[model samples]
Target chain A: MTVNELIEKCGFNAVSLPEPEREINGCYIGDLLSWVMGRAEADNVWITIMSNINIIAVATLADVCCIILAEGVTVDDEIVKLAGEKGVNILLSDKKTYETAVAVYEAI
Target chain B: MSESLTFHYDVDGEDFTSAGQASVQVKKNLRRLGIAPDIIRQVSIAMYEGEINMVIHAGGGEADVIVSEDKIDIILADHGPGIADIELAMQEGYSTAPDSVRSLGFGAGMGLPNMKRYMDEMTIDSTVGVGTTIKMTVYLNR
Candidate 1:
């Protein structure tokens, strides 16, 4: 699946720019930056409530396919712009973290 | 086996966001060396956990990675308050990190265990008031 497919399947409202085609593996659900830094794999969907730029750093380091900002959290515009620069797909969801994770899994 | 490459990093304790930079670099180095993705993940995760512990528990630390044909060895040394009880600290779900650290998505007490889990061999040396040093190795052929 792709990031666009995930957003469509979950019926998540796109609060930011849409994503281009990217590969999707599985989903990793966690907010612990260090844990996700180690646990998240390349081309995986990283689900978290963290909206910090460090989250973007981790996503870049882990090479995640897309980041799902769960719970409708708002973030600085710079993050989304940086994601575009880094070729990482960024999406936002109004659903809770767990529900978003489940939706991702079901979509996969 | 003799190491083909060595990388050393001085981890800054003040920057929570930069904690895993060393691990990220190491992962890239290993990937350029044509190491398998699984092996690179193991090395990166083990080293990243160590890096986080250094920033969270200790003020900061030093990390050294030696890469060779047979294995990769990571040494993380910190001058922060040492572990009081190794046994208890090793137990899952036991954490002493402050609330702030948890808010960053850590302090779940899984850092140490996850490091140990991903590495083939790990050793911890610490003195209560002195400091702590962790040495972890991931075998290339494993």
Candidate 2:
């Protein structure tokens, strides 16, 4: 399913939807940026609690379809702006990381 | 054969938030040069890891990317305290980064290993109290 479809089905708040139509092929759950960088496949929806700027670089480098900031972890306006500028899709979920993964699993 | 292209950037150690800027820029340059997506990903990831290591442990460094017809070379050099044990450092899950870096979602001790995992060849030259230099190459035909 595309990121837009997943967002609607999972009830996620769109933070940056530059590539809302980007397809989601899989899901990866991790908080360690380096580990996520190496393991997360392209087009995967990365679920994490980390909201630093490095997350933006990781998402871009990994070519992830979108990032779901789980556990209600919110980023500042600067991060959202960077995500938009870099063409990285981001969604915010009130659920925890596992729940976010399950939601993505069911939606995709 | 045509001449190789090189890109250079100085990593700013003061800002952890901007660690991977060079890798991001390198990714864009490779994309513009029509490098394959997979190759670009490898180069970007390897360089990104190295860049992060520089900022976290070495107080920043210099990074260079040399792109040629058959391969790409990435070199990272830093003047911070060098790794006393290269073997230990190469081992996965062995890192000397402080708690502050770990809290930022890094310092899982996978930087060098990840760099090796992505590059075709990796080498390190480090001296304690002096500096460290890492050179990695990724072949295009691979």
Candidate 3:
């Protein structure tokens, strides 16, 4: 699914979008960076509650399609800028992490 | 190419946030070299897990990546309390990391297993109270 579709389905707001056409290969929902690092596939959508710049770095390295910030978490502006520069999409939601994951899982 | 390309990185033990930087760079470098996407992802993910393990468990370490025509090899060396049981450590969900590390989204005990999973060959050498050295190789050819 496209990022926009995911946002609409999950009731999330697109905080930042590098492009509307980045393909979503799959979905990986995890807050553990190490676990996600090992399991996340390139072009996969990563859903998590963490809001650190390292997320951006990981997304860049893994070539993930986008990151959805669950649990209504906020990120540093630099992170948004970095995501834009790296061409990774970032979305935000007010739902709890588990709820967001369930929604995303169901949508996927 | 006759000459092998080598890259070395010194991982910081205390910074969980900054971990995996080297692996990211290596991934970019491999991509630039036109390596296969599958091979690149395997190498990058394996190295990234190792890097996080070094910072979380070993307090820091050194990583060396040697890129050759046929394969990519990664050597991770750290001077920390060595693993008492290599077999036990290899099990999934076994971790020695503190609660703080877990709160930061690590210490899942999947690092070594994932590394071994993606690499074609892997060797682990450790001495109690001494250190640990892991060598992993991923072949370029399918």
**C-alpha lDDT (0 to 100) for residue B49 of candidate 3:** 87
Separate DockQ for every predicted complex: 0.45, 0.87, 0.61
Q: Estimate, for each residue in B28-56, the C-alpha lDDT of model 3 and write its tens digit.
A: 89889899988888888889888888887
Q: Give the lowest summed-lDDT range of ten residues in model 1 chain A.
A: A12-21
lDDT minimum window of 10 residues, candidate 2 chain A: A99-108
Query: Model 3 RMSD to the real structure?
Result: 2.3
Clashing pairs in 2: none
Query: Each model's fnat?
Result: 0.33, 0.82, 0.62
What DockQ does candidate 3 score? 0.61
- Which residue runs of candidate 1 sit more than 4 Å off their true CA positions? A8-20, A34-42, A60-63, A81-87, B1-3
**Alpha-carbon runs more than 4 Å astray in model 2:** none
DockQ-based class of model 1:
acceptable
Q: Kindly list the per-residue Cα lDDT of model 1 for residues A65-101, writing each as its tens digit.
A: 8888899887788877766665667788888999888
